[model samples]
Target: MAANNLRGQVLSLYSRLLRMSRNWNATNPAETIVERQYIKEETMELFRKNKHHSEPFIIKECLKEAEARMTMAEHYRNPYPRPVNLPKRSFSKKEGKKIGKAIQKFNEQSRPIYIRSTDDAVGRSS
Candidate 1:
């Protein structure tokens, strides 16, 4: 759970940095390029460190973001191919049904705690 939180923090920071770069580009074109490059390098380094620990969704997002940014940085490099093909795995119907039931059971057990935590978070944030 602690590791997941840390990974979330890193992902949030990366997203913020990307937004800042886009904003900078619009307002300060000359400075934006340099700043963007610096941010890209820093983000790449941080991402590499946490890559193995990243969740599936985050890893996908990171790869997509990196490819987009790299294409922008190196225009001469051929445009990235559409529909990056990630490897797929298959499971039997029995396995799927078992997994679904397990998830449902877990959610049913944790729903109250999850709601309380969410309420607490909202109350604190506000």
Candidate 2:
């Protein structure tokens, strides 16, 4: 927040912009890659162009503008913040027709693991 530390503040903002940009995973891999590269190039260019600025007031204004750009990129650039949900294929669909097999369902109560005693009727909880 200090006017004298504009350099550090801008650098922090730049890093944050890059970090948040990586989280964007649109339906297409190419789009995400392009957007990420754009964020990096844009941020670097903006900071590099204003590196020689010495006026505290100008520097403060520049940082504010950079912060606003970062905010817009974070919220507006990517309409979908959460990752795209991919559809899952069933076991039969994944494997070829030759190897396709249906999932098996089993009843545990019918298994031999359970033992019924002669007191089955007398031991009834009801």
Candidate 3:
């Protein structure tokens, strides 16, 4: 099954990351300790946090991101994640308060909701 394959991939990637953390060799002597600790902590935190997710596309995206990060680290000889340039948002105080309330309401929803991917639809209908 596809889920089984994804599970295997996740386990393999997790083990690889753990091993990498233990064996990390930094190009910059000053960054060795910081980068190693970061790799281990980030790996543990992100994997544990997302372990409960059942969405196949979400899992695949995470796996791709991890692989890309690993490749980038090897190429750059840096284990830390690259800084993202997020766009700045400028909301008025009133708008910000309203947005905050909306976010809180969304988070407090009682039931979990998921959008089924096309793959799920096709597989289930067969």
Candidate 4:
């Protein structure tokens, strides 16, 4: 039956999303749990919202879009939470603005120095 087929497709998509969600991480365990719960709730809600659609063309198109979304999410999802222990900045917003150029200068100091010479060094003595 068409209804049965549609239900199966929706279930399959939902499970795929859950598996995908497992690969995501948040900065901490509590955040991770919250994120996973949000993902599950949003997914179930989307599928439930469309549960009554019976038209063949609509179902087909919806399935195709779902597949595309799954592929994109799998490919482009963040690999992991950025480290939770990065050094916290002590600067206030105003301090940060005041020291912006100093920060830029500090970063630039790390760059490799480059020297340009017009003469071939081997041919001429210093």
Q: Which candidate is the best by TM-score?
A: 3
Give one digit per residue, the lDDT tens place, for model 1 in 61-115: 4445454544543453322222322224322236435556654444434433212
lDDT rank order: 3, 4, 2, 1
Ten-residue region with minimum lDDT total, candidate 4: 115-124
| Residue 26 CA displacement from its true place in model 1, Å | 9.7
Clashing pairs in 2: none
* Model 3, global lDDT: 0.67
Model 3 C-alpha lDDT per residue in residues 1-126, reported as the tens digit of each score: 999999999999999998888888899888888888998987887687668778898788668767877777878898766654322432223643555655444432311121111123222111
| 10 residues in a row with least lDDT, candidate 1 | 117-126
User: Per-residue lDDT of 1-126 in model 4, one digit per residue for the tens?
Assistant: 987888788788878877767666655666777677765665565566656777876666556655655564456553222222213443323643555766545433322121101113211110
lDDT of 1: 0.46
**Candidate 2, lDDT over the whole model:** 0.52
* Model 1 vs. true fold: TM: 0.32
So what's the TM-score on candidate 2? 0.52
Writing each residue's lDDT as its tens digit, candidate 2 over 5-124 gives 777787787788777667766456769887777667766665676677777776765666556555645666653222322224323223544442232212212212111111142221
At residue 50, give the lDDT of candidate 3: 69
Give the poorly placed runs of model 1, Cα more than 4 Å off.
25-29, 50-126
Quote each prediction's TM-score: 0.32, 0.52, 0.65, 0.48
